[model samples]
Target: MSGIACAVGLLSSKCILSAQPQSAGRILLQYTAVRYRRKPRWLGTAKSKLFRVPERHQQVEEEVAELKRLHNVYHTQMKAVRRFLIDEVEASKLVSRAGMVIQTPEEEASEWEQIQRINEEWNRKIGEVREKRLADEREQRKNYILERLVAKEQRDQENRERVEERVRLEKELARNYITRDNIDKAIEMALVQPMSYNFSIDLSGNIRRLGEEQNQESSN
Candidate 1:
């Protein structure tokens, strides 16, 4: 018991040996009173007066600085945490709102109307293309017919020129036929001329062989 009391440091060995349970409790109570007796709080004048030792003043300053540092660190961590939570909640709400959005009937109808307008524009463009194609076809056909007519007129002119040229050659042959001596000579001349020249020669030259008739009259 004495060793225990000495180890506790609150009581002497003699008091511990002499004490009963009531006396021990009284002693503990007295010790507690002494330990808890109200004193001036160590701040302001009280701090200057009570904490006279350099060690005590240094301990108090270190404790205060440590507490301030911990408080600043805690506040900074709490601010970051709060901002992160707020941002996360806002993002979640935005995503949820997006997922929940539904198009109004009026908006849907407007979209359909816009689509129909686009389709109508497409049809109009197609119609314009078809009309242009038809007009182009008509213009091309007209040009083709005009070209054919011009070609036919040119061919007709060439044919008429050929007929005129043949008639001129036949007149030249007729002048030669009168000078020809005999039927064999006329036939030989016809072989060298065009067919039109041959047709221009007739029985008039045969019925009146120029020299044969003159000879027959001379004989009569």
Candidate 2:
């Protein structure tokens, strides 16, 4: 086939494919041998086809008859619906006008007072709820602060107790501590005792001091 004919066929196939369900995966690729440039607006139609007449597309008789029937039915239904809506609107307006009553000055004042009372009742209810919510929030905040203060006091008490325990321990150990006045006495006691760290553990888990075992064996 010619390039132009192939292009037209491909374009028509693409249009048909686009209208089909997506499960069909058919694709058509268009190709052209020569690229044509568009004519400028200043250049009029070619003189060769200046007087040619275009042919009209013929319509089928069945399709024309069916289209005309559908159009007539649609127009008739739309007209009926429009008239029904217009009548309903006019009836509603009349009913409303008839039901409306002209109020006297005293009646109007009474209605206004009733509306004011209702507004005031609603305002008072809202105010009570707001105040209660604010009170609950304040109470929660106060409790939180009190709890923090109590926890801080407990922590301070624990710290003071720990300090007092350390001070008492230091005071108890002060009797053995080597100060300037007790340095000579502490040296003399250490020399007489001669402390030893050499010890042995037997299979029975009893500790035997090396110096004491040697002294006992020599005495025996």
Candidate 3:
């Protein structure tokens, strides 16, 4: 097939080169006849022969058709190549954009971590404040209990003192009443000594001594 294609190429090249001379010779012959006014029958026959050279014309036409087909094919192939190149360029652009997107999360990761750490620190500080507040409340409660206990003890002491004072006043009032009665009885005994026994004054003094002994025993 390769040898056949080579032979066809050689034959087509020779025919194109040969067709130019035939065309020039036919033109010269026609011009000479026209100038001499002696038209030859062989010239007319040659014109017919030239016209009948359809094999060469057909060959030329076929060559032209083949060339046009080859040009169209080459144009289509070039278009396909251009499309593939454009697709490759667009794909590279997409890959570059993806690379930039991938770096964003990595670049900001440290800042996110810092934010989390700050939040944890704030939470710890809040917890500490709460613990301190709770401790202060507990201390306040303890102090309140101690103050209440002290106040209660002071009140109990005051109540005991008031009871003791009431008892002392009652004893003093009874003693004063007993002393007034004893003196009055002694005066009556002394005035009636002549009318009654002469020893009534001594008897009155003895009764007073007995009352004093009874008062001393009641005090204890």
Best by lDDT: 2
Give the candidates in order of TM-score, highest first: 2, 1, 3
Model 3 per-residue lDDT tens digits across residues 14-85: 221222235545532222111223333433333335556555434588889999999999999999999999
TM agreement with the true structure for every prediction:
0.31, 0.53, 0.29
Top candidate, metric TM-score: 2
Instruction: List CA RMSD, all candidates.
Output: 38.8, 11.5, 43.2
Alpha carbon lDDT at 171, candidate 1: 93
Q: What are the lDDT scores of the predictions, listed in order?
A: 0.72, 0.83, 0.70
**Rank ordering of all candidates by lDDT, starting from the highest:** 2, 1, 3
lDDT of 3 at 120: 97
Q: For candidate 1, give the lDDT.
A: 0.72
- In model 2, the worst 10-residue window by lDDT is 14-23
lDDT score for residue 47 of model 3 = 31
Query: What TM-score does candidate 3 reach?
Result: 0.29
Extract clashing residue pairs from model 2.
none
lDDT of 1 by residue, 38-125 (tens): 3323322343355566554456888899999999999999999999999999999999999985989999999999999999999999
